[model samples]
Target chain A: MRLLLVEDEKELSRAIKSMLVLSGYEVIQAFDGEEALALIENNFYDGIISDIMMPKMDGITLLKTIRKKNIDTPVLLLTANGQVEDKVEGLDAGANDYLSKPFAFKELLARVRSMIKHYSPIGENTHISYGSIKLSIATYELAGKESSIMLSNKEGKILSLFLKNPTQIIPFEKLVSFMSCLDAKDKEIELYTSILNNKLDAVNANFKLAKLNKGYKVASL
Target chain B: MSIYGDRLAQLEAIVEKGKTLIQEIINEEVKTSGISPIEHFKYRIKCEESLINKLNLRCLPVTMESIYTNIHDLVGFRIICSYTSGVRTVANKIISNENIDIILSKDYIKHPKPNGYRSLHLIVKLKDSDVPFEIQLRTIAMDSWASLEHQLKYKREIKHKDLIVAELKMCADEMSSTDLTMQAIYDLIKEEN
Candidate 1:
């Protein structure tokens, strides 16, 4: 998963980013809300974690602005103050959840996982269809018209991502970033792509993962 | 020969701890309400074979990390109450506890399943453990119906499956109504005394 973490404290941001990275999440750090907003405009994030207090813009204002723009990305707000009013304001401004500053890292990780699991469109459904292929996210089984094949967790995630963005070329960097491996190499992704292609062939899927210049896209067979 | 032998043992310990914690909460609720809301409770740690089967069904690798992240009900508790109100009382007491974190709560009693199953499900994690567990609260009547329904679900190649399912739904509805009436009677008796 990819996350945009907006925090004004550089030291704390670094600490959190490292921890998230170790937990198989690709984290983009933004020192202030405006920078975070700029990143959000150009990129897609699985979730956003932001501190309430920031220099250029506060988290609440950023949240309100994003909501006004019809961006429904799940957001978790972090605040130094543990006041009920702060949490209420954050939720009122479109935050999905909030955490007080003096929180355990374990709690933060759990909350992040919960928010993403609850908010993801694919998370709510058992199966998703692209072309003539039906993929069960719950079972990691991809079914075509004639047959079906089970996929490894990594392969399932990659296929799910491709299916979610059928028309776009997903960058190799983004693909590698979301993989569980901390030091995932391009070759490893290539191997996974090959395995996925073989599975598609096995199941007689009407669509295949086509390699682009520096990315991959689902193409009609 | 199971790779998860140690993990299963750990989970059993956690289940024991969870049982004690839930029993304490139930006892405290009894003191405040002048009667125990829960009629009885049972707890279990998921066995190795079942865990492996679940992992394989989900196409997850049979690894410790996969179990930790993907499975939420390594330990499970079933609390059966004599009345529907008792189920709510026990659920509220557990939810209000400060010692455990509530990960998720589903009130199937208010909005029951399509098959008419009724229960309150909770996923919780204790303060000291990173592992999450499940708690299910249901009235005695609902429990009875669910137990039978579960049996019917697992029976392979049952004749007249649709008819049996419809009958089961009707039975669940009757049981639910009876539970409500029983709770009303209990309340009236308490009022008279």
Candidate 2:
């Protein structure tokens, strides 16, 4: 994902830029709102993160301008003034999101990811397909040529990850990571694996052996 | 015009003719409409002082802001209601005056920005004034929320790393909806009456 970060603080901007880059995102940084506005016209960014206080133009003004131009890209504003009137004005001016300074990196990343996922367009398969089985992420269901089964919430998610990278080996560690509420205990992990395998089998999905590996792979049908 | 000079001129004019303007309008209103001239001039001033103090509007010019154009040629008042419907109630009540004329209005409620905001604005010319001022009628909850949001989110950078922007947006939405819902209850009450 590509993100544009507009902040005046050199240290904070550098730190955030490095962190975002390390997390596998391309980041374009600007020191002030004017520069940020100029860059916005020249580049296509997935998201924008801006500080409210800046030289030449303020964050609220920038947001207002961008919105007037009909740019629907999600904007996350950072501000130091924590006042009721200021917030009302910012919201009134059409900022998509507002964050105060001194924030955690993890929280920032999560917000960015959520916004991107919400606005991203799927190029081809509106339905994620793997082998003979197709899972609709939109409806959260699994469908085959002859029959269709509504997947439980957990099963539906697992199926989505598999469908995204079909015919590929999904390491056990990666699968566990995909399951947000999973525990690290060996028993629970084993149980989760068993449940996943059962669901796949029930759905008559393309499968392969566990191979005594740390993760499982989706084999050809 | 320099802000100070312009504002001072306005204030001086208001103070100079405030009482006469009030008395004349009250007499005229009572004669034509037969309503009691319970015109509380101080109520309007007190409301202005309270709003200025509460909103920390010290930076504003010391002019006839937040006027009470009802009695004075220049009047401003903020109608603070218990629910959102109160905004409409007060607005409709004011407009019911055949002597009043609406100059400008804004409906922030029906068409809020993406950030989730709602408010109603009305500018009315009282029975006698050629000049128009402002009257801001908003639910107390909306007023309070607007105040908090200004301080917490819009004024400066937020330092809270725990709550993400999405969470903040959700909170804003909930508060906005609550304001409207509270207003709806008031509407129901008025209907019963």
Candidate 3:
């Protein structure tokens, strides 16, 4: 998962960023809300954690601004005060959840996980389907009319992406980013695509991955 | 019969009760304000197949306990209003009720989806039940746009998908502008009266 950590306190921000990175998440750090807003405008993150009290703009104002601009990225607000009014204000401004200061890192991680899971479309749905095939996200099984095949984790994730956006070409950059494999080379992605195509053929799936100019899309056979 | 058959029935009952409660609130509001905020409402309980699929997707054990704890939108209500102002008014009244506990509120109307879908979504629990249900409030224009967008979005085959998506977004923006103008005209007529 990719997360943006916005905290004015440099030392605390570093600490949190390091911890999240260690936990297998891509973490981006911004010193204040303005810098964070700039990054937010250009990039997409699974979740954002911002402190309520900041130098340039407070987290509440930052949140309200983003909401007005129709950015629906989930936000978790951090506040020094644990008062009910503060929490109500943050939520009323569009924060998904709130955590007070002096919280355990474990709790923060848990909240982050919950927030991302709740916001993800795949997390809410049981299976994704296109044409005559279905892929069960939980089991990593792709079922065609005649048979079903167990897919590797990477293969399942790749197929899920195509299944979710059937007929629409997913660019290489987006496919890699969505997989959280920023370091993956083009050849590596090509190999995975080929393997996935072979699996589809084995299972007699009605759809196959077709390469476009700079991306791939699921096309009916 | 599946083990969850009884649980599904129970959820349906909860939805029925929630609808009745909301109707009562609307009735009281109309009695005093001389106008109804809600143009119409629709309610549903999640189907058994979907419930099972959701459980499997989350990797949760297929048990009644898991359903109660993990699922929040087993029952849902969609409220359609004639204008944007009516949407807010209806939402305010529903949240003010003592019998409901607001667990989450997402003002998609203020912060719409990137695709331009707009609505105010609330996840709440009735006082008598631990089950949480979702309430969606949107103006007629928004409802119509969202309904059509949802249908087109899930289709497997479409030529010029990007163009269709852009056109839908344009339509949504235009409808929203129209809704605001209609609201402003209504306000002016009310002032004159």
Candidate 4:
């Protein structure tokens, strides 16, 4: 995914850019909203994260301009202000989500992933839920109420297939069809599934992956 | 003249105004009447990609006229409440409005679909704007059920579509009962206090 991060602080911007790049996203930086708008005119971004306070232009104004141009790119506003009204203003101006300053890095990543998942091309299949565990297919993130962790693309697809057909014993053949790895053996499947199960345990997810007669199924913990 | 631009502006206005009207109603009625009927509300305009995909899928001409006449759900507002009574209450507010005409209403809550889909869908036209849009009133359980059903329906490939549909239909029926039981418990608690 390609993302545009607009922030006035160069140090903070670079830090965020590096973090996003590490997570397999192509990111571009803009110092202010005007620069962001110019960059947008020439380049396309799957999502945008803009600071509400900026030189020459602010995030809210940029949101207005983008919407006025009929570009429905998903925007996540980063604001120093924490009031409900300010958040409401951002949303009313057509922002998809907002994050407060001094947020944890994990929260920022989660919000950015949320924006991307919400605006991704296969928009309908982006987010899926089963009970308390919500999965974002675009971001490869499985989020429970108390915690969340990112998954590899293959793991995400595998978990998603089970969630879609909850309580059903997915046969090995059926599970293999969901994986793109042609030479995926049973041992390799166990490795990926173990990683997913460990993450689920960390998150205290109500569901667990367990072996059925032939394949795996998700059962309540 | 930019007729297309003007139409887009009108649609935005209808969406903004409709949201404000509903919000104001909830603010006033919930405060004075001591009953909070709405859990949450959201509005959306069909994005360009989805619109184009729909036009091609339907084999419709890519013309503004075709869109204006047939794309009744281009602008959608979903109002979710906690109980069935709240659905009727909110729908009545829209129906009784002087400047709004109810083009038609699908009473799915009273008579659910064969697949156990239940929600109240109203197609309405504003008197001054002359644009038709859809408003969906549903309980939270119904909304959740519809979302899951939507996910099931939109898969590009499914090995057993019939089996999935059957399972989803059964889940929807169970959810409807759960909603009724929750509403009853809420009523009992309110009566006690």
Residues A1-221 of candidate 1 have per-residue lDDT tens digits of: 88999999899999999999999999999999899888776566778999988998999999998867555679999987657888999999889999998889999999999999887536466888878889898877776664454566777788887776565567788788556666646656765676677567645677888887868878898
lDDT of 4 by residue, A1-221 (tens): 67889999999999999989998888999999899988765454668899988999988999998777645668898878566777899999988898888788889889888777666332356787776778887776666664454565777777766665454455566565555567856645555555566556534577878876777777897
What's the residue-level lDDT of A154 in candidate 4? 71
Clashing pairs for model 1 are: none
lDDT of 4 by residue, B76-130 (tens): 9999998876888899988998878999999877556777788999999888877
TM-score, each model?
0.46, 0.31, 0.45, 0.45
Score residue B105 of candidate 2 by CA lDDT.
Answer: 81
TM-score of chain B of 4: 0.92
State the lDDT at A169 in candidate 3. Answer: 60
Q: What are the per-residue Cα lDDT tens digits for candidate 3 across A82-195?
A: 577878999999788999998999999999999988874354568877677788888766666644545667677887767654534666766675454556566556656766
lDDT of 2 by residue, B1-193 (tens): 4333355455444444544544554566567746422323321333344544543544543444433232232345545566554456456756665666888787765444444444676665545546565566666655665667666665456566346454544454456544544444444444556
Candidate 1 residue B40 C-alpha distance from true site, Å: 0.7
Task: Give the share of true interchain contacts found in each model.
Answer: 0.00, 0.00, 0.00, 0.00
Q: What is the lDDT for B119 in model 3? A: 92
Model 1 agreement with the true structure over B101-181: per-residue lDDT tens digits? 999999777656767787999999887788999999998998999999998899888999889887787577557655654
Worst 10 residues of 2 chain B by lDDT: B36-45
User: Interface root-mean-square deviation for each candidate?
Assistant: 23.4, 20.3, 23.4, 18.0
Listed models, DockQ each: 0.01, 0.01, 0.01, 0.01
| Leading candidate by lDDT | 1
Lowest-lDDT window of 10 residues in candidate 1 chain A?
Answer: A143-152
